[model samples]
Target: MFWFQEGLCCLPTFLVVWSSSTFIVNYLIALFRRDVDVVFPYISDTGASPPESCIFGLMSTITAFAGFATMFARYKYLQRLNEITGGVSPALNKAALFFAITSCVGMCFVATFQETAIRIVHDIGAFIFFLSGVVYIILQTIISHKAHPYGTSKRVCYIRTIFAVVAFLAAFPTIICAFFVKETRLHWNPEDKEYTPHLASAVSEWIVSFTFVFFFFTYIQEFKQFTLKVNTELLEFK
Candidate 1:
């Protein structure tokens, strides 16, 4: 009980600190750049210039953290379920583990390249994450359908199909955002002889936003399915 409480407490603290640090770093970048009007892009309702880092940073951070947290919690949950159920589906368990590992690696990349061209790599990593998830679901669906023609509920099968569909759809926006977002180019303005922030054009903002929404839905769907499966099994045993 105490360990669970400690783990829960650490989760929020990690989220807050990481989020605050990212925001402050972005704020500093904005302060130093004369050409960049705002740190974030979408916050300007009054034609105000976008911030140096948009709310996407915050959203991404939250999403990534939530992904990692869900992965962690689900790992333990699945392990315990496997033990209770005389070993849960190995394929499903392995898929969850792979997702968790790749998600963490993606998070590290994002954090490490917050303000550099390397951030583009993070987008590529994200695309891979989506693709991997889609593939995993498709494989799971095929295997489940074959192994348990009538053992698993139709609802479970439907959920897996939905996961693959959504993930594939989401991958497109992520790819667009990765390719379209302008890289920040450092330039010396001859007039002032000072370095300036030449932000990439604003076209990619919508792509980024759409990708966030898509991934958020993906996470919610997976989490819901996992929770439902656990609950159903527990109730059946009871």
Candidate 2:
């Protein structure tokens, strides 16, 4: 039997692939072109209104869709938890759902107001996305510990716990570097033989982004039971 839930759950995977691919491809090209700041340039900078702005914009659009799908998936996951925990889902599950939704909205806002046209709104959206993402991961780590109605394996939960911790740790520094780092200027020293900026927020930002996306790997176990409902009508979500 076909399962809409399985498809829905996989939306995050699609998000990971599409968004990552767009950045990786553009960043590689940008590296050779070196037209942008490279390190300081936000991901949205890849979509600056010129030759490849359209390309990056396309990626942002894809990310927004992925974020929307992820929000829906989180809602469904929370509902599943409610069923599993005897109609009393953990508070964390519901809270995570809300944060996930906020992150989705942030993604859409960033895409709609790309930095070139509206820098402040874009910055605000990026902050929302990153901060809410950390909160969502922390909540999910708590949720994964409960004995899920879907019989998600303990092993899977442990894996999630590990990833969640790493992701949260990674995300905080990204925000710190973005906001508080006073040294944005590049530094050169023959002692270290490295020409780099004192504040390399981009490095931390990429780590946060990749780790956050990887954190979604935890949901694979939760999606198993969505396979059982043979009723097609139920799949319609009506």
Candidate 3:
């Protein structure tokens, strides 16, 4: 509990680090592998690469662990929002927190069931995570706008809103390329051939992931003046 409180504030920022670093590390590792190239888009266990698969699992574990702590911090933001809004709706933040945790759990599923390992579970997890992520962003943006206490100004919320939209909008290109593009390629193995990930899809995926990271990073300003104590589960923005 003490440790959770002490490190809770850094979890979201660390997520940006971990996810981005994982991408770089996994990409570099893939560069050395004979199976895939730097151009692969289905980055999150979408293809058959061992280290990349491991990286996906690692990312899920990382998200869940960090999310466990950061969710509390996120809840506090909502609580403060309630305070500013005269406590008009008590359940809103709670529901938002629930969705945030659900998103983390989805990441866990994606991690545990890599595409090659369990396609059905992987697909389900991906869907849940995607939906949860978008909703979480929407909720957080609302909360941030309302929780104008501490150093969180309306301007901060506005900036966050823009980034959140960027993160959300960035997904469209990837989705479109995924559905419409025919990424057919001859297999390295003469016995078999299959469709590789499209370049547009991969590039769009990068954009989406990077924008998502930036969107979360906007919360650091909100968390900057916030503090939490373990013994009482108390949080305050000084």
Using TM-score as the measure, the top candidate is 3
- Taken over the whole model, the C-alpha lDDT of each candidate is 0.46, 0.65, 0.65
Give the TM-scores of the predictions, in the order they appear.
Answer: 0.45, 0.75, 0.76
- Superior by TM-score: candidate 1 or candidate 2: 2
Off by over 4 Å in 3: 1-8, 45-47, 84-88, 149-151, 173-200, 232-238
Indicate the TM-score of model 3: 0.76
Pairs clashing within candidate 2: 47-53
lDDT: the better of candidates 1 and 2: 2
Which tens-of-lDDT digit does each residue in 69-160 have in candidate 3? 67767787557656756532567678778888887888788778866666667767766776677677777777666555544677777887
User: What are the per-residue Cα lDDT tens digits for candidate 2 across 116-207?
Assistant: 67777877888898888878877776766655434467777777788777767767666665665332222223343222322355666777
Writing each residue's lDDT as its tens digit, candidate 1 over 142-214 gives 5445433333556666665665565556556445544543543333232432212112222233333333333
